[model samples]
Target: MRSSSRLKRAALPRSAPATSAGGSKTDGNHGLIAGTAAKRRTKKEADDAQGPSKPAPKKRRKVIPVKEPEPAASGSEASTQTSHADTKQPEQHLPSLPLDVLYEIFSVLDPHGLIQLTHTCKYLCTVLASRKLDWAWKVARKNSPGLETWDPPKDMSEMRWASLVADTSCSNCGAGGVTSVDFRLRMHLCEQCSKDGLIHSSRLAKAYPDLLPIVRELVPYTNKKLHSNKKSDKYFWIDDLQSMDKKIRKLQAEDPSAVDDFCKERRDLVKSILGRASYLRQWHARYMESRVDFRMDQIAGRFQAIGYQFEDLDNPKFYLHPLVRLDTPLTDAEFAEMREVLQPVLAQIKQQRTKAERSSKVLELYDQYKKTLLPIQRIYVPDDGNFLWKYPKFSALLTRDTSLEITDAEWAEATDALPTYLSRFIEAKRDKHIALMHDRYPAPDAMEFITLAASPQALQHAREETMPHFAGPLELAIATFTHREDTVVRYNRLFTGRELCNSWFEKVKFQFADRESGLVAQMVRMAGLNPRSTTATEMDDLGAQFFCRTCHNTDHERAKAAQEPHTLWACSWRGLLDHFRGSHPTAIKIGLVNHEFYTLERTHNVIDIFENWCCNHCSEEAVAFLPRQAADDHLQAAHGVLTPSVGRDVFFRPPALNVMAPHGIQSYYQFKDSIPPQASLSTKEPSPTS
Candidate 1:
């Protein structure tokens, strides 16, 4: 049967290929081929009856003739035209989108984004301003974060409402930084604009006396309160008042009877405005607050992205910066611009905080060391008190790359090294003192100077010469041991080492006493008394007075000019030594003044001697003069010093001496008992004298 079908298909004279229901060729179906062949024959007969077929003609399309662009008269015009063409081409495509598609795109944006879109081109502004797009604005407002709860006022358009709330600019001047809105006036005003455009209620009467009462009643007002407790002044929009006034005047001119009706309508309008403004005001406040919060979050994210910790965001230095506190969102480009300035400031703040934390930790460790380790360490080495940390090596050991904790092993290491550090510190201090002394008093040979310093007499002489002029070992030790690198060191507290400083002080006092003894002996010998046996008290009782030959001769003119006792400069035993050591560093020749002459000079020149005394401890310039009792009281109260010494702590001022008459030589014992001695006058007047 297959062979018969194939022969039949071949005999069909290659009929048109028959297709299956699915439109595939069916070579094996003989019935389909027969049907296809019969239909082709019928189509050929129909074509022959209808004759030749022809193609239908195409419909003509209307051609739009475009004018060729004119050649520019200038390069600027050509460039302007080119730019306009470029911008116009892109702008044309955007508006070519379907109205529904544009609405859908705008509806997804917030009011701020929608407002920004309007600023891009005039086409967008016109389309967005159309009443047809009003639904799109409403959708945007509804989708916005903080504006969802509030609707535009009845009299306000959605665009105007969005601008009033979202635009950060003064409506009148168009200046930026106006984050707040005045809903009552339907505008945003900067601080300066608010001051200039809003009329205070008190000022309204002066500015427009005739319209004040009606304007105050009809126009919605804002309370201008500068302070919390102050009484707020009612501020009306100047533009509102002018417009209301013109309307009222026009109604009176056109229809006098309707004037009242117009006022009543305005009153109702104002009521509505005020009611709507209240809700809008609350909405604006929430909006601004949310914007500020969003901006702050953006700032924190930017900082965190740059490797700052979450806790670092809470630092006032970061949060209070003007950039972080802005009510506008931070953009990546803005962060890039501000990073140069902000990164350094943030780094400085972080460094300061780290230093403070490290200092606090070191202080805590020091406190523990002082209470526990110090007492045990003091048994081996002299106590440095609070000055132990002043040593650079010791401080480095305590603070060198240490963590917050001080382990027992670390403490043990420090304890073991304390004696060596203390020894080094002492050696350095001794070397410093010697170097300073050698620098201050340069010698021809350094070895010879050291050899001389070791001798008792040479050392005493050196001390007498240099101690009054230069800082001694004790002063140098205090300065070096208590010095701080960060701040000026206050020498309010005394620094004393129990074994070390006390022994040095004792040596200083002994050396000073030995120098004073030599001077006292010279004075006793000048009084013609035995230098070995004559006590200081007996010499004072004798009223032994001495005069400097050099001062008597050289200072005669100065004494005369000062109106001082120019007959001869008389001095007591202590005054003689002070004058010789201070004024006459070279060998000074002195002779004892006759007792009668000395008494007479004292009687004439010692005017208010007790009143001219000064406290050496308080007065560095020796200009603070006080009476005997007042000086004693001041010493006790101010310095906690009792029984101040005469020549050492309190001295007679030189200007207190008056010119005296000359005297003849007489026996020293004759007038010794003539002057009844007082303890304060025991040190004779060193005034302009030797």
Candidate 2:
């Protein structure tokens, strides 16, 4: 009865109306549900009547709950809420594009941009590597600015050529900073990788003796000579050598007779590769040079936009700047980022250059001023003038604000004023010396409350004798301070340290006393006088008969060989004192008292005393009791009197012995072989001549 009811219900479906739960006819959704059920039943019956093949079940999608619309907000509130919603919206990624669209997009990219795009995702990498996309890579290479003239080799694909040209990382070890491309090997290698992977031709036979001769000839090689005298070594890429070796071995194993054909084909391929590599090498050099020039121009333009000018834009500081050194086109944003660091460096360089230029100008003006002042100095201050620049006033003039503006006329005026500055400088120097002397050697009466004073004559004589000692040390200190060329430091005494001056004075005073005592001892010994009892006047009476043993001995052999007289260096006691002070102040030696020199001097003294002749025409300062012949020569030469009577123009008087040889001795060789009277005399201080 159920089966019959089901069959009857299934058969009654033509435009059937559905009933409600109350058994009344319903007009809305019930009719629609009944019609959809009847249609599904009919389709099932149709599928059951057909053959057994059935479609796979479809997965049901999740149903999301619908949100109802809210009441409209006020205009400002609505905008605020809309903006908040926009801000909270999830980030959207690049949508998948059709291959046609991607190909067009990639076509416009450069090699570097295409390389970067390939690394973004595996999808792009796989798509870019596909054979269909090869046209896009060719377009990219073609559109590249500098590489438009170049194309991939026969064996190299477009993508590979782009990577080889664009990639900066080593293909072997993945190291960065690579700028060179080995197009023959289709690899970018760093210095270290190249070193490790390259096999020199010199080592190739020894390292791989079994490597075929044809394989060696067929491999592309790089010629590099470490030294000029040596022949360039051929370096083959190790991988290329191995690959060719392996290929040759496989060919021999597969077909023993086909090796020659393989070698010929490889030789042709390698020849083409080498020729292409050579051209690429030259192109790479020019391209790198152009790139560097372009980068420098970019840097210069950026600097100029900010009001800076560089005469040498290729200066290492600018050329090596991180942003400027990049192997890419510099963008405005990149320049702006680097400006903060680079601008300060530019400013410093500009300041340094400006300072150097100003210093050069100042030095030029100084040199001109120096030249002008030198002649004036030679005329006015010849005796004691120092370099003009070594004066404080002159240095100040050079460094003054208006120094650069100083004209030739202004310099002339300055030169005229230099004499006055020199006077003040001398005065100041004297005052400083006096002050240092006072500090070093205080006056005896300085501490004595009621000390008796010396006579004016005595005081003046004492000062005259002492002043020269201070002058030497003061000059030494001045020279030491002015050793550098800086004008500011050349003359400033404050910069010349006070302690240095004091130390110099102390040193000079001590050395002077020691040297003077040694000289006095030497003089007394040579004069055969009692050192304890010999007065200054007594020593002076010895006249200028002494010679500096140090100087004479140093030049004795040379002089004797040349037959030249050694008497030229002979001087009186006073002259010897001056010579010692000037030439050998630190050492004191008098010529040994040899009998030959002693007898010669004594004989000359006797002749002068016996003649008793003097020059009466000359003033007291010029008067001298000369020997008869010497007197005649003097009258003729000095007074222009060829003949003068002893009672008239000349007078007779006994004079002290004048041991000075006013004219050099002509008989020096005559006494050269004479024996010393005191052969045992040594450098030891002689016993007081008792």
Candidate 3:
């Protein structure tokens, strides 16, 4: 009997996808024994062990294709009914199936196969559409690779709900949801059906040897090529090595290079088919990103949830992994050692930082700080970049009661003096640093741009993520106060803020012009702070975004306070990116080449090119950026000379949208597992492997 027909007989309702009881498709007897003819079982006899008897014929339409009322029975209706009731019985006993085994059997079928079997017959459909089955379907769908893409038939939703009411409760869970039984059953159906049922067939073990029947059926095609006058079956895998050797000899005689290229092409085709492995692995990646987006998205709704907006979420990697609770308490001895050995050194370093004259001097102080801060009790790391000497609460710390704190005249003079001093510093080291041109660099007031970029949501949901909103005060304040072109440019250009609006058509640029360095120095002075004294906190969001009263609108404190949320938006160090992109379409597409390179860098090819270029520089500072292994290999292979960028086609592009360690699969897992056990770790290892 045909497989579909056998399945239909086993299931009466024409819904169950596969096998059934005695008369049901699931019946082991439905198929012929190894070498014997299969026999049909009556529905009644199948339902109950009894003598063979045909099932009653279902009523047919009248000759006119219309239904006609049946005439009344001639005999005593009550007595005849009693006799008929006595003749009938429940269904035949079938093999027992435990729930776990059944669920396992159902899990392997892909969604497409499951749908085909569902239309076979009624009795089978009832079991397939049961509530227990629905729950299993849900679990399988959640875990399956491609089944997540399946969508169920619309009518099944209502039927599943109705089925739930008919059943006492689901056999699997003895529970129900808001929906009815049939609806739930249909909703929870498994995606994999054909393979699952085939496995359960009694003959499956014997059929295993002939498992690839589909392939065997194509033997005619295989033999044709093998026997062809000019062609040979060189690419096909043959079990007999002798036969394969013979085929290879024939191919070499026919045309060796043609065979070679054909084999190569076949290998390439195999890899292309395996590409789905690449796609499926990244399936949950976007899901994880969405979770982060959602968390950050809540900032406006509940600001307090943020640990402290001292920075934009800097530890994005750690956040996505499982959260770890550090419950271990420090012992008395540990605490004492920490305080005695570390606290005093930290204090000394802080004092030296206050006295430092330049960044190099501060770098020296940092060395001491790191040494003294061992068994580190408290250390602040900035978000969105840089560090400050103190934690930021800038407006509160710098504000005075009087209106005459720092004069406007003094502010202008300080700003004017900055350009020349910075210019001299840049010229002295012109060859060492990449020149920042006025056309490419950001203007002094670019902090305003950053303030506008900060936004609240995905900026995309599937394809659309909304820009975050931040108010105007924060933008004006940061733009008016910040002096560094790089920081201002980074803040203003890269992000999108929901609040601040700016004209993308107008572009302002700051030129290095041999002046950026001294201007950097004067910038610190004019702000009444020393960069050398700045801690991680000061250089980050707290200092850059909150410190400058002008950025915070402190001069008109009441007016700034009234702006509240908008004020927060204005001073945001990164939000302006969103504003520009939303308000100025031209701004985002303007740097076309940069965007294209970024696409490649994301896949890690860019790093290969970067190491090649930087290897030529040879200077200690120049080589510091390469990954440890790459740099070590370069020194050994390139004779200690830094690789010159002169003839190289590669350039240092910006880092990936989300940067992580660029180690391959096995190394990433090892590195992750090596982290302190108490620290939270992701179940998935970062895979940079192609």
For each candidate in the order shown, give its overall lDDT on alpha carbons. Answer: 0.53, 0.52, 0.29
Instruction: Supply every candidate's count of residue pairs whose N, Cα or C atoms clash at under 3 angstroms.
Output: 0, 2, 100
> What local lDDT score does residue 326 receive in model 1, on the 0 to 100 scale?
76
Instruction: Give the number of colliding residue pairs in candidate 2.
Output: 2
- Model 3 stretches astray by more than 4 angstroms: 1-149, 152-314, 320-690
User: Which candidate's TM-score is highest?
Assistant: 1
**Candidate 1: segments with Cα more than 4 A from true spot:** 1-80, 87-94, 130-145, 150-158, 200-213, 225-232, 249-262, 268-287, 367-690
Write model 3 residue lDDT over 1-690, tens digit each, in one string. Answer: 112111222322223332224433433322322112222244445546644475555843222222443454668786677557545421211113333454576576433223333444343355555433555455444443433553333323322322222222222222322122112112111212211222222342354443332222111111112223532222221222223344456777898877666556534544442343234325434433433355443321232242323122223322232221111122346445534543344444433433332234334433433332111100111111112222222122223232234445543443333323323322232211222322222222211111112242311221111111112121221222112334444342231111112211112332232222233333343344553332211222232221122222332356445743221112212222233323443322111011111111122222343442233223334543465356556656655435422112111222322112221111001112234211211222211110
For candidate 2, lDDT tens digit of each residue in 1-690? 001111111111111221224635443333434565797798778878775787634744333343553555667777678667656332211223333456678878877778777666545665565444567788887776677777766666677777777666667665667888776665666666666777778787887887777788877876652222433567777767777788888989999899888788878978897778878877886776676667778778878877776653546777777767777666678777888888777766765555455456545544443333311121112232334555554455455553145456755665556645645544454345445421243322111000014454543343233222323333221211212223542122221112223233221321122334445556666677654434443343345366666776676567678977544345455445445655775666665334344334222332333554566444333445556777778878886878764333454343221122222121122233453213323423242232
lDDT of 1 by residue, 27-111 (tens): 3333333564797698778767776674334534333344577666666878788768966776766644544567678978878
Top lDDT prediction, candidate number: 1
User: Model 2's lDDT to the true fold?
Assistant: 0.52
What's the TM-score of every candidate structure? 0.43, 0.41, 0.17
**99 Cα displacement, candidate 1 (Å):** 3.8
lDDT measured at residue 482 in model 1 versus the true structure, 0 to 100: 19
CA displacement after TM-score superposition, residue 253 of candidate 2 (Å):
7.5
Once fitted onto the true fold, the runs of candidate 2 whose alpha carbons sit more than 4 angstroms away are 1-167, 172-175, 181-186, 191-217, 221-258, 268-290, 311-316, 351-365, 376-690
Roughly what TM-score does model 1 have, to 2 decimal places? 0.43
